[model samples]
Target: MIDWLDFVVLSLLALGVIFTVIRFVLGPKLSDRVVALDTFNMIIIGLIVFLALVFDSKLYLDIAIVYAVLAFLETIVFARYLEGKNNDNS
Candidate 1:
């Protein structure tokens, strides 16, 4: 059933979260870690949306939207910091 498929997708996303955690732990560069963190945030948002769809809860969708916006802002802030560091090194 389609519901079963959604469960599978959620499990796969959980695996992705684990992988991202590993990358965050082992990444050689700060940028590499930041990229992984960004990926994790995006994945979390996607999972939330999928859960909302499966549960037929409109509230979850709103939460997902807020989370996405916050994550995007966090990514932008980190990027700005990295840019500043690069400029300083130059």
Candidate 2:
């Protein structure tokens, strides 16, 4: 049976997606868009974990872990590139 917590988590995920979309659409800077994308990725990881717990799926949890690692790597690479660009400009 689906619980209130599941519904709440799903709702939050939906809200996060909506906000991410807004950021992507209206963001004035590359960094702002990157931050929004990072948030979206993290939210997806959280949602996956939540669903895994709800459905008792170890496979989903494993996939979530993999996704988290990839997201972290992406963030690090973006940060490094942005920082290098700033350094070059200065």
Candidate 3:
């Protein structure tokens, strides 16, 4: 039941995930890797939402919401850790 537009969007999302993975792996700094991980989480949320739409299922959207919340919390923790590290060096 998926249309061409849906296919295109999914393809783009996949490509984005691939590039983000590269960034995550090759990032020279902890912050860069954290940013890439955050971006990857967002892309995964997008994929979940899109899949929910394509399959006409609300469950996927609910999962996406939970995942987004977790990702946000994780990002905050990472930020705090980085801040603490910086303070220790100062």
Candidate 4:
């Protein structure tokens, strides 16, 4: 049974994701978009952990940990690529 608190948390998370998506879409710079993407990933991990808590399941927490690692690696790669691109342009 879902509770009011769960509904509120989920709603807020959903809204946060929506705003991040909007920022990603409308960002004036590639770095801005990358940051938004990274933030989105973090938000997803948060959602996964929240679900794990709400359902009392360890699997979701495990999944969130794995996802967080991957997201961190991906963001590092993106940052490196952006740095190289900027250096090349300058």
Candidate with maximal lDDT: 4
- lDDT per residue (tens digit) for residues 1-56 in model 2: 65887888789789989989899779999899889989989888988888788889
Candidate order by TM-score, decreasing, is 4, 3, 1, 2
When summed lDDT is taken over every stretch of 10 residues in candidate 2, the lowest stretch is 1-10
lDDT of 2 at 67: 98
Comparing candidate 1 with candidate 2, which one achieves the higher TM-score? 1
**lDDT per prediction?**
0.93, 0.90, 0.95, 0.96
Clashing pairs in 4: none
lDDT of 1 by residue, 1-90 (tens): 567787788889999999999999999999999999999999999899988878889999999999999999999999999999999999
Model 3 scores what on Cα lDDT?
0.95
Q: What is the clash count for each candidate, in the order shown?
A: 0, 0, 0, 0
Q: Model 2 Cα displacement at 23 (Å)?
A: 0.7
Candidate closer to the true structure by lDDT (higher is better), 1 or 3 = 3
TM-score of each: 0.86, 0.84, 0.89, 0.92
Instruction: TM-score winner between 3 and 4, please give it.
Output: 4
- Candidate closer to the true structure by lDDT (higher is better), 1 or 4: 4
Q: Which stretches of candidate 4 lie over 4 Å from their true place?
A: none
Relative to the unseen true structure, what is the C-alpha lDDT of residue 61 in candidate 4, on a scale of 0 to 100? 84
Candidate 2 ranges with C-alpha deviation above 4 Å: 3-5
For model 4 the TM-score comes to: 0.92
Best by TM-score: 4
Candidate 3, position 88, lDDT: 95
